[model samples]
Target: MQEILDRAKDCYDSGLPFVVYRKPNETDVFGVFQSNDELRSSKDFTEKGFVFAPFNDDNQVVLLQPDEVWEGKYQTEKSEAIKDINLDESGKEVHIELVKKGIQEIETGRLQKVVLSRKIQVRITKPPFKIFKTLLSKYPNAFAYFIHHPKVGTWCGATPETLVKVKDKKLKTMSLAATLPFIEDETPKWGNKEIEEQQMVSEYIGDKLAHTMERLEIDEAESVRAGNLWHLRSEVRGTMLPNLKVSEVVRALHPTPAVCGIPTDEAQKFIHKNENYKRTFYTGFLGELNLRSQGELSLFVNLRCMELQGDTASIFVGGGITEASDPESEWIETQNKSKTMLGIL
Candidate 1:
């Protein structure tokens, strides 16, 4: 475990690019350290490297060349809450206003749903690797990673939503949305808004994949726990069409309704126009791409994530908004979502 992080630190110190990650429900940690410092882009998605995509595809899909690889078995140490997590909800009003606008868009039939997010920048009291250790330890079922590049800086996250996982022409992904504070031993009573919000994402994914897949199957939606919160989740799997380009499938689902909204382009326009800040790679997906031996692709949405710079950790949280959404409740949902990262901090 120490060796995996040690090599990552050495790579970062040399201003090179690397990604040290542990997949969900796995006991092994993996690292991809680029031998050079070149800032490479994977536009065609054929690159056999680590992919770091941005919310808007207009930005380059930064690829960390898989020059050196490391794998190790790791034991997770439970993260203890150290900081009094009083997040700066100063943007609460702005986020609520954005939610209101989304509702209006839905009411006027411009969009069926929209996912809006806000940032909370908090100071850190620990080193980057220490924080990553806590995060990697805390979420045993979340895809945890510490990725650094000279051009892209540093990003640490334990994402719950998966964009895609492809191997041998078989692909699997999930529609994950709607958040609530998890109460131990209690079944989450999901309301209509939450159910419909998740369903919209599932249907959107199914419809999109219909054209890209040879056969598709979607499971019933269920409640799943991701750290301190519960989310509505539905697994979707299919057989990819023979010779279908990986890039084509990724483009079909990059900004799914779970992250963007129904009528993706219109909601994306709303997000870009009203969010008032560059999301960068917050809601984007990142993971292993094109393992030479297995020809695999495992990617997860960049949720419950933060960008680390100096002593500050900029956390990103968001929720899906339908016509039935409440502004105050949405803000609180983000607050609950932020706690996932804040707890480790």
Candidate 2:
């Protein structure tokens, strides 16, 4: 464990590309160190390394060529609460207005739903490596990773949403939506708006997978907690057709109703027209592709994450907005979500 940490620090200090990650509910930690500073792209998924893809398909998908791979087992450590950083009031107002606009579109029947997001930049007093370690200790149930590339910059996150996982002929995914603040020893209650929103995502996933899957199964939705918030989630599994490829499964699953909206294309257009900021890698997916000699893949949505640039950290948060959604309440939901990353800092 100490060797992995030391090597990761050396890679970071030398400005070389590398990715260190641990999957949810797993004790094993994995790191891939690239030999050179070159940034490579993976279009066919034939390359053997970690892939960092963006939300938009037009952008390049950065790949970290594995010059060396290391694995270690470590016991989970308890987390300590860090001070909360206050969000900019002006920025909150702007995000609320964006949500209102999305609601108006839904009401007019132009779109059934659209996910809105805001990026908050916070000044960091601690080193990024320490924050990365804190994230792993705090979110043991998340897909946590720290990726650095000379071309793409440095990014880290502890994501709860699994976009897709493939091993041999089997494929698995999940539809996660809705949000409520978690209280100790209290039952989580979901409003109609949340229920409907989560359902839309599940149905959308089922429909998309049907095209390429030989057999598909979906489980009932249930409440799952992540840090200070609780979300409704449903698991989806299937056996892929022989002709289907890894890239095809990713395309069908990513930017689902949970992150994009009910009708994928239309919702994406609205976001591009109004969000007022580029999502970049915020809602993007990242993980190992074709790991080892065997064909096993694990990819996750980029949530509960931040981008480190010098001393400032840009935190990303978003929520699904429907016709019944309230602008102020949605704003508060994002604030609660941001705490997942903020508490580690």
Candidate 3:
């Protein structure tokens, strides 16, 4: 671990990119250098020689070949099977209660922010990790990461959040992911609440990207649901100024408002104070870098994720909080989102 960390630090210092991975055998560490010798088209970046690492338990950031790619996805029908599974609180009910709680806290001036989370129970008659591995292999674009420590069993996920994407003069990013279990025939809709949250994320990102890019284009976003929840997503594209570096863009976009929350610092401080848990790598971004190419970057938000051990999986889940948010509902949202991975278990 120390050696890998040292190598990473060295790469950072030398202005290059690298990836460190924990192989399936558990205990084997591997490292790869991103090819930055040339600047290939962005299309090539998504199609060839890409690798991925754990961005968080549920999310993975991928570095692709810009050419070689596979099409894989899993969207389950709204399962009566899921209805049978036990959940801590009815999601709708929790939303109402948590919102009231958050409102009261704000009303009383206790906290300006609080992130709530809940767990959904899943019963599996078959081996859970095996099912997860199958899902990981299925999504060729997603990262297949699992660690088998004595403390945690098998952890895996196929995340879709792009923490950051940097090219020579361009940087792009997305915001606001909500997780819920997959439902059959669920079409994408731009509802009021979804639009509202997405708007906030877009505004925040536009502000950040403005400082780094000379020209920026914000797109009309659609709804994307990962695992059990749905998120409002917008694509923000910008061209970096002559003096800016790719690392600067990455540093600016990480832990965006979608995954973290608005009033970033205050929200993070509140999370540390009240969430009563350590996020560790849960929300951190991870992916490969193509130092050999002109520096193509693909990152994902660490959502719909879990930590895998031999026989036990310690799943980590959370939700974003806003001044307009409800704590109970946030809790249920995380629970519902956890279903993305929990269903397999």
Candidate topping lDDT: 1
Model 1's lDDT to the true fold? 0.89
- lDDT by residue for model 1 over 1-345, one digit each (tens)? 789889998988889899999999999999999988899998787778889999996899999998888999888676676566776768888888889988998999999998888878889988999889988878889999999999988999998889999988999999888887889899999989998888889999999899999999999999998888899999998999998988888999989898899999999999999885789999999999885544589989988889999899998888888999999999998888888788888
Cα deviation in Å at residue 46, candidate 3?
21
Question: Where in model 3 is the C-alpha error above 4 Å?
Answer: 1-84, 88-132, 137-144, 147-155, 178-182, 186-191
For the record, the alpha-carbon RMSD of candidate 1 to the native fold, in angstroms, is: 1.3
Which segments of model 2 are wrong by more than 4 Å?
Answer: 84-87
Model 2 TM-score (2 dp): 0.97
Q: Which should have the higher lDDT, number 1 or number 2?
A: 1
Writing each residue's lDDT as its tens digit, candidate 3 over 114-151 gives 44443333444445435544444444344444322221
Off by over 4 Å in 1: 81-84
RMSD to native for every prediction? 1.3, 1.3, 10.2
